[model samples]
Target: MTQPGIDAADAASPRRIRIRTCVATRERHSDEKLLRVVVDPEDFTGRRLLADPKRRLPGRGAWITPQLSALETAEKRRAFPRALRLSTAVDTGHVRTYLAELADGPDIVRKTEH
Candidate 1:
């Protein structure tokens, strides 16, 4: 059952990806280029932050530039708690380590500036 004017190909094709703003850089990028951070539920020691690369985690999540520098800047500015809308202290060490590992991976493309 196809619509009158809509092509079957178009319907079968993937939907457009929604853009997300980097909380650190305030720049808009595709969701894939941004890393989503969420509070670590298992870390009862404190409010620890973890990267949700798959973006399938529950609860409030904050998006940041996937680059390590941007993550560091966000940490310096204390953006996580405010971005996550939580008063509890947020730890970004895990997120930093994750981004660092990704940046060092051979399969990940490193963006270059002209």
Candidate 2:
């Protein structure tokens, strides 16, 4: 019982699919909206630091705090990639720059001289 043109094997072949999930949110002293990244859904592999609101990306996902301190810790101990179990090949400098921008904002500044 098979189709004339298509075969059962062909039908079983995997197709392009998208997975989505939240990793964790970045916080400052338990109350702050920093930044978040989208991770791979399939087994939670691969992590991309997302800047925009729209979490439109290919593959599964997890979220990450968008703070310099958190990012530094993640990068230092490499806990981020471990959580997702994939090689995180993102430039650390870009993350620093983003944190700096956030710091410039009134919300993050909080009259702190740093």
Candidate 3:
């Protein structure tokens, strides 16, 4: 059975979860638990990668686990170009800086879960 205006397929489908895959880990996770980045086209030298903490950039984006190791792994594997559908390498310095800012997120590394 379906609603008057809805297609049967639409009515039977489950609510979608916003999941994304981490380029470094090759794992799927909630977007909220991952970080997103995109290649900046206006850099004029080489493509520059930018972290989208707010997830607001306008072009194709890639997701990764929020760790410096993960970021470095992705960079080392040349995942950004494939993930973002670009033809060349991107400058990762900007994204690295962003990760540094959020490094260790909370001050308490032992028990403060907030």
Q: In model 3, where do residues sit more than 4 Å from their true spots? A: 1-16, 104-114
RMSD of 2: 13.7
What's the C-alpha lDDT at position 77 in model 2? 66
Question: Per-residue error at 79 for model 3, in Å?
Answer: 0.5
Model 2 accuracy (lDDT, Cα): 0.50
Per-residue lDDT tens digits for candidate 1, residues 24-98, read: 888999988889999887877548888999998777888998899898788778888888887877778789889
Against the reference, the lDDT scores of all candidates come to 0.85, 0.50, 0.87
RMSD of each: 6.6, 13.7, 6.4
Model 2 CA lDDT for position 75: 72
Cα displacement (Å) at residue 107, model 3: 8.6
Quick one: best lDDT, which candidate?
3
Task: Tell me which residue pairs clash in candidate 3.
Answer: none
Error (Å) of candidate 3 at residue 14 is 12
Question: Which candidate, 1 or 3, would have the higher TM-score against the true structure?
Answer: 1
Clashing pairs in 1: none
